[model samples]
Target: MSDPWLMPDGKTKVDPFVEECRLDEIPFPVWFAPYTKGERLGDMLWTGGSGLKIASQRMIDALQDAKITGYRTFDVDVRDHAGNPIKGYVGFATDPGPTTDIQNILGQDGQNFVFIANQRVVEALRAHGADELDIRPYDPSEFD
Candidate 1:
């Protein structure tokens, strides 16, 4: 199969930042969890080349039942490549396939560090009866 990064004519499709930093070959995994006490406490939920495995329904149920709210999803910067902040959609694990597909594209490997602050996962948690959730933007500097 042809590489997504290559053009039909075989000239490399140059992503200035990606090429300069070799970001494409990195293995940065996706994460899901809440921000608490100015920290991101979560799990390495999925990885690229692994075909979109999301956290199970039982895990979500447990998080809700435990009253663990304030959830957001993001991925590690892996290489900390500057000026390439990743951007992507944020939604629940139970959201429809198309929604997840969009999110996957935005959060693809070797991109900037993507983050979804409030709203996304919190709404899902609220629907499951999480009452004390907070919505705050993730601070990338924390990783620095």
Candidate 2:
């Protein structure tokens, strides 16, 4: 099964992802669906929907230890494929602080947003392994 809000006919019944959400619009302590696939490894992870920044506890600790800013963390509850509780994870959000003027990056999935991670974030993501982000430079002018 896909996300709960996904219909069998390939449509979504609810707004997908927390990307454009305002602070008050989202419920604190985000809840994730059962993770039934993959090794569930990586300090940073991607879910099918609900695009909150899911980071492992080690990543969170590293971020805090480095005094990273412009983001907030929320508690999250996740269960493995077998309904086993998966601990040591949290959801986070950033405020787009201190960005350069080379603006408006695009996501590989045009419908979603992709962001650049700095050295601090890269270091944090290395808790398990290298960040496996799909980077595709998009220049929207080609569509014109």
Candidate 3:
């Protein structure tokens, strides 16, 4: 059978980095962040739910134009507290730094508000001032 995450056309539906990073290599981090209603509203106004989509499309276009392959956008889920269901999207690549924009809007450190389970990604995020995280060992069964 085809890979579960692949599209019908045999293309990957998620980020290609998910595979390159060996995200399934047992105990990789899945990041999370919860936003307030106001924050959500502001994001909507800023991107109209198209920021990542547009960026991804543009990246794809550029890659196609250059005849390059294997590049993809980073995927992140903005979910509710339970992390059961994804409620929105946040592009890891497009996220503003903690000191510049997002943190100012959050009125606190963005890292303090973000959640991540992957140690490697967490370290990267923390290095950028997104130090506040809920780091935990990866549990695949929890997804089910």
Candidate 4:
């Protein structure tokens, strides 16, 4: 993750913008930049350690239904390079995992702010067919 994340639009580059944010806060909608091509939004987005989490509208609903915490979400206005409204998406800012292996929440860790999801989060994503992420064991030393 040395280089910035190249978005699906092939135009937007998401760089690490925030080192951290309060769990109760919902930062401004994260786009980094607009997309030129008509690439659809993924259920889960690349955060680039921005501390802001972007998710599809459906994903948001799923999370809400699960009643998870440590984050807040808000509406996001996504648009094409031409400014056409891209709907059904939102952004959230969440708490860090405290450099531990969590088993019941959604959080980030380390330099890359890699997503560290608990089993419940994984199940929610899996149930919604939004499992486009890699599941890995947490190695505390990585962040040292």
Cα lDDT tens digits, model 4, 18-69, are 3343222323343432322436557756544354556677776776777655
The models' CA-based lDDT, in order, is 0.36, 0.53, 0.36, 0.53
What does the lDDT come to for candidate 1? 0.36
lDDT by residue for model 2 (7-95), tens: 34456443443454333444343356533366746655665655555667776676677666655676666666565667887765554
lDDT of 1 at 66: 52
* Model 1 lDDT at residue 45: 30
lDDT minimum window of 10 residues, candidate 3: 45-54
Better by TM-score, candidate 3 or 2 = 2
- For model 4, the superposed segments whose C-alpha errors exceed 4 Å read 1-38, 47-49, 96-113
Error of 4 at 117 (Å): 1.9
The alpha-carbon lDDT assigned to residue 126 of candidate 2 equals 58
Q: How far off is residue 23 in model 3, in Å?
A: 5.6
For TM-score, candidate 2 versus 4, the one ahead is 4
Task: Point to the candidate with the largest TM-score.
Answer: 4
TM-score of 3: 0.24
Task: Please give the TM-score that candidate 4 achieves against the real structure.
Answer: 0.57
In candidate 3, how many Å is residue 65 off? 15
Worst 10 residues of 4 by lDDT: 99-108
lDDT score of residue 12 within candidate 1: 57
The candidate 1 region of ten consecutive residues with least summed lDDT is 87-96
